[model samples]
Target: MRPQALLPWCLSLALAVPLVGLTPASARAATDYQAEDAVISQGTVATNHTGYTGTGFVDYTNVKGSYVEFSVSASAAGTSALTLRFANGTSTDRPMDLSVNGTVVASAVSFPATADWNTWATRTVDVPLTAGTNKIRATATTADGGPNLDRVSVAAAADTQAPTRPGQPSCSDIGEDGLTLAWGAATDNVGVTAYDLYEHGNKIAEAPGNATGKALTGLAPNTTYDLTVIARDAAGNTSPASLVVDCTTKPSSDTTPPTRPGTLAVSGVTANSADLSWGASTDDRAVTAYDIRSGTTVYQTVTSGTSATLTGLACDSPYTLNVVARDAAGNTSDQSNSVAFTTKACTTDGGVPSSIATLSTGWTIPWGTYWMPDGKTALVTERDDFRVWKVTKDGTRTQVGTVPNAVTTNGEGGLLGVAVDPKWDTNHHVYFMHTAAEGNRVVRMTYDGTTLSDYTVLLKGIKKNRYHNGGRLAFGPDGCLYVSTGEAQTPDLAQDKNSLNGKILRMTTDGKPAPGNPFGNYVYSYGHRNPQGLAFDRNGRLWEAEFGNSSKDELNLIKPGADYGWPTCEGSCNVAGMTNPKATWNVSEASPSGIAIVRNVVYMASLRGERLWRIPINGDNESVGTPTAYYVGTYGRLRTVTKVPGADQLWLSTTNCDNNGGAADGSDKLFRVTID
Candidate 1:
């Protein structure tokens, strides 16, 4: 049986789901109940597959009678659409019986293959529902069990409110043939479903609710047209028409091509995606779009922004990218300068994480974990409280001592990273990075097996903010101390080589700059936003993971004097001097924290993403493999992960008591994960 099979039954989640993509005739307000949050029999909640919504999905065992049941509520009893979003990777169809209340409403419902586990498809059925609450259950009829169940959305309540009026219509990129129309998004009680564009009271085009901009094409040249927009709700209620914009198209008979886009740059080149940006091109009419070419083939076409991200590229492969601008007359410009780049190598072990058991519990915001030289015990730090505890391998925890003079920033501050000196057996020195009244500081203390004493300040000068106080410390294989510092929410500090903030600092045991330093200062590598994870691979090469602002989070390979773009670049960009990340993930997928390497695999702990990521380091010792997430949404707010010395196992800790975690004190726990 899978380790997760032993977890307690999942409780029903009560949440509202927006009604989207529905036509007015069939629109109904809906609520989504995650499969993982429903009652399961002979199944487990899993995150191994991508595209599962609301944390995870219920993975059923290949046995008859496997089922997941959800409790749903409706305002009134009536016929409603029950949408089941699922994925089946196998070629064989998995048929299931859907039961409402206690009666089977749909029998032998076929769930066809969706290509792969990553691909999702939804099946909708009109079912009779009672007022108030109803129990909906789906059971596998054959030994193949049911398809991987994502969630079930019940559309019951009627949405009657119309969407608010859209913002006044505006025109841009006007040309002789066509122009671009844009307006602000309209608000709806349930959700806006679509928008209709009208020209002189006749509807000409339609766009999805999520879109605020539409490209108007196939219009007559040299003409004046008045355009307006109307927002529509799922129930077919249309908002008041937006104010009209009078746009005059340019004269016809023009065939001038646009100038080539300038200075094509790429950065944040990951295994599958690269960021591309170039100077805008000018045209006699209007530049309609920029076609990004991979060699001779157009990889992507950008219509609005000067930047475009190229995705779906192969790992560890070379690619030459150039941009060509196009005018309204279909005339194309010359190709821009070619920028040749190689995507980062991605490797994977395909290991699935099974919960062995919770090793320790009742701890609050356990921030850092580091094994002792003896390999039988480890020291842990609590972020909010300046306390240190020595935890044995068998789960015995003893509060050793608290670091004095440590102050809390009240958010993401207080006692943070803890690292035992590699020569601790002889020197008995242990180090800590914490927030102090002055700023963030690195301090050294003497640990004599059972207790901690002799506190001494090693280094200071790293600025601290209410947030972004980077506080992770480790001793590199070269016997030098490596510290990861945050930018203190100051983006400029990351690009400033002279500032210690937003940098990976390398220092001696006494806190002076390490020998052969990059800038003759403590700064080893500049340009980091909020670097938290720092671990050395088996090849003695450093790897770091940090949080991204709004778009992407990054996992980068650290090098001496390498500049990692911060405010200037989020994920992958084509900046000239900035180094790109080896892997990039959506911020919703990886607000990463501490990382540890075991058997050449870097295990990263995510905070907001709430998962443990395993990324394999290739034999080349430089590029990383495809990153896979494990225990996603199963554990809340993973804070730190550390390799158990001399073992193929890792110790993971959680910070459920943090502000974002929102759990009560003593709600956190420590877990042990074995890599197979």
Candidate 2:
């Protein structure tokens, strides 16, 4: 029996499923929920859900690069919420995020996973739900970046009570002699944490002894004010603010300045404000007020605890701020130090793109491209979410297919490279380098905008490790598939031409070689280091674009029987028969992944450089031009480049999603560039 088969009856998930929910035709996106009422939650009750509905599998095997869409029915369709209660069945303590439909629902930090394979943790993502079978997928994400889903209960729409209305702040009351402020207790299904009290607008005291509560205190007489309370449960959910209470403060001059904060530092800086954050500032009586200074001028003031946001500042400039504390009894402390930062530099370097525009939507992870059969659209491949998108001259893209039973995700599996058949108009076929269960394989598939099928395996036996299968497929001038496979990390395998690793594969359109004398239809040339790009110039000479082993990246001209050194001679060397690079860049400058020869110019995408190096392709073996850098760092890391149909522009793909912390607003992208 499989490991999951030995599990107890209560937590078992069955692989074979009977999905009785909405059909694909009835699928639609959910909108935001209006008029939120009080939310209530209860403690988790252990119920034996052995045979639930819709895609439940107790024997959950590895579904790498694929989404496990639970097709369970909702209680009343719109009365649906999502909860991921799962057991970590593996030793690897990898983390992943959860998503609903196509929208990003949460990050790993928001839903932290555990490596304690024996225990189970449940997380909930309460979003607006639609009627019918809501396809809830447990998406897998990791820092090293691969998809690995363990056991999870995706379809458990159990009948439970509403969690308390959460995320509200506490309140405080002030009276003439002394005030009495009371707030509702922080409530949750698990338990409440604490309550905080606020007076007038300031927190005067705390209740419940924890991070929760509302407080009451003395004040000036005859001043009318409103009071509110909030609650926080143990699971970190806070309740809604309660109804307001009217109060009056007694007259008394509590004119003491709040104690001065000790050391202060400028935390977050943007165009508008410097988020002034510091450690907890103390007070003798109570921290009543704060003063902010710019250089030596009394700039502004605030009454808060430790930190406050200093807003209304200049962009792309330097500024400094100082903060002072005061107590309620009119005692003032010295000003805090270390609040300074340089503002956002929009134009640090002289060379950045002045304008950018969107190209297409629904095309994900687009990494490389080949011109379609009609010469009107280019068939593009992506990094993750591997699907083929057809990019046309008008800047529109349509997702053709995910792959031939291929998953678009995991660390490196996806639709990678697309090669249109030379007789594509008649044959109606295209070859793709994609990830599969058997490993990396070259597949021939039929394509329309929404449908994909008729998969014929062109070449099968490639070793698909988790990383670097070197999947780039292209048709040579001789009308043959000149495929490039990486040695991955097995360097010794690269030196052996007998194996597919580290060699350029030469085969007929259907995985056979052109009638040649080079080893009878197998190895074209040997010695390669992740040869990700293959293209021919107008001169009909084949050039390879490859990143070196942690050193210099090089572009080499392929000779029929030459060795373009891999683990041996990197960058360039003084050796015989081993081809030297015509141009070289340090590893920092070029993780040069993909290149395209357009109008006698080779445009190469730099994943590390975050720029496109336009090298003039003089001929098959020759390339000149001073190499211009375009769109450096505006978009993060660029991966692939494909020439626009009969034009000077090329489409570039950004690679920030492959486990890099890109900006929240901007991560991986597809850029269109026009070379001068």
Candidate 3:
């Protein structure tokens, strides 16, 4: 019956084991199932199948009167969980209620649809779990009569104990290197503790019972050994020793030099010896000089620009030369493809600047850069971490003022995009986009170059999604402040002009939208995903760069009352009413964030692609230019791009550390761009 019902009795045996069809168990479990907590989407699932399989399932047999309860506890108490393929369905999509301890913790009426299972799909249910058995009851409810508990299947609790070591025998092979081993953990009422490792079945090392990870290190290189570990529990009950795992250490570091290049050929040959050279390579990440042999005698070793000449040999006298590439680490690549050829005179290419030079002084997360009326002090937005910086022409950086209660340090939630008050030197005003306690807000910081004073809260309460708040504050030539916002994953908000989410709001120095916005002059434009990077040229045209998760990044020129489709469309909108991007980037090469117009070109900063691009514009809301690849691999990430006062230099910020996984030590740097 019930396939032997794989199970064990916890502390509370609740002996009332009801038969499958004995009672009408619908009244007590249906109505009480609040869809608030049953959505446990973050647990581990079995990944052994070619596609996806589940070690976890929902049970609906224990339902009563519009409510469902768990046999013991909720899903969180689980130490190990079942993982399904991302293409699989959602927890609630199958009509399930997650329960633990006769209480419904999480329930879902509708499963949120998504392709990526990492970000939006992990819904934490509200129910709590105890230290015993757990069950998730999935039941349905009918308004008129009844038909909800149709598909009911119960999943037996998972067994975390390690299987017994099958057929223990004798292993005598041993090596110099340290040993590598692995084993399964013991099952438990809750979870197992550390695992005790053994050599020759004797206690050696103790590893954590966490199954998702492994441990192997310390010993002689190139050695072999047998190892095994026993899963131990906090309660002192140990599982059988797992089967022995055999492993070997790595071989000695490869350091042999490559063979010499042979078979030199003549191509584009001339009377004068053609320049001869071999390809360059690095060994162990180090590059050593190349050894060249002319005839039977040995030639000098060249560090760079492979290929040496044959001098003092009779004109056109056949000669054999070999080229070998070596590295500083004493490791060399295979000899390059052999080439037989004559000597060629070398020529020089003229005049490349030692390297492009730009002034990066006074730059600290300068999302927005502009010159005060006097053109002496450059006002750049310092973001929330650095606020506003008042720097003189000589590169003196000073803080304007900080917005109190700022600093989100979470995904795109923090102080971002900044703009100078159209009349900065005259009116002493500055504006910024920051996350307040409530939500994303656009505020103004008032200051006089020397002593900054007072912060004015202009706009607040805009919808804030962790990763996409669309922060790019700019002041149009009309002297109106523009704040771009994100949709917060709520698709409907993008089309709702009245809602601040997914919109570009044009407001006065204070928080009120400009007097003449599209909707009663309150909302500037609607329908945007996450629009960052905004700028207006001398011609008074606004352009913005936006980030799309899987699609192309866009360089959009904002038009009043126009909709840059968000949830409805990504790029190249074939939809009836949607705006298209002026230019689309692959996101890898250009997640364009901050933009600055200079010398009739739009210099936009790329986030994922740490480079600055100068797109030439023709005043037609479009641009063309050869994107200059800079800091190429030098800086891990780039965020905001802007132009300096002289009009020839550009500025951008690196966001490696800001996004986590980045080194905290000076990994984030401000780069200066000078256009030659």
Candidate 2: where is the Cα deviation over 4 Å? 1-357, 361-363, 407-410, 448-450, 619-625, 661-667
User: How far off is residue 414 in model 2, in Å?
Assistant: 2.9
TM-score order, best first, reads 1, 3, 2
Candidate 2 lDDT tens digits, 1-676: 1122212111122122121221111122333211011111111212233322233322223333223444444444333445554544455543445455555555552334355433456555654345565544444454332222223333323222223533433334454445656544444544455553433222344466244333344444446555544444332233434445567565546544455577777777875457776555675466767767655344445665666776544345466778776555445667778466776754222222233455654434566678875668877776666666777766677767767556532344566788887666676778888767765778888765345678888676554544456777777655667788876444545666555667788766555444452545356777887788788776556778887755678878877767888778888998887888777776656677788877776777887766676666544335463454555445667778777666566777766666432333224566666643
* lDDT winner: 1
Top-down lDDT ranking = 1, 2, 3
Regions more than 4 Å wrong, model 1? 1-355
lDDT of 3 by residue, 1-676 (tens): 1123212221012122221111111111211222223332222223332322223222222233334332433333543221111222323243344445455554543333344233223232334434465555433332211112211222223332432322232233333333335343355555566666554322445667565234444544554445555555543334444555566655536545555444444344543333456655545445557765443223335666655653222123234555666654344455555446643332212111122333344333445566666667766665537566666644567776666666663456777776677556566777778877667777776766765567767667675544567888776666667888876544456776657777888776655556546665446777787788888776677888887766577878788888888767777679877888777766656667778777667777776665565566754435543333334344556777666675466655666665332446334555555654
Which digits, one per residue and each the tens of the lDDT, describe model 1 over residues 142-229? 9999999999998864544668879988999988788999999999867788988866433578899999999999986777787778
lDDT of each: 0.82, 0.57, 0.54
Worst 10 residues of 2 by lDDT: 34-43
RMSD of 1: 28.5
Task: Flag the better candidate by lDDT, 1 or 3.
Answer: 1
TM-score of each: 0.50, 0.47, 0.48
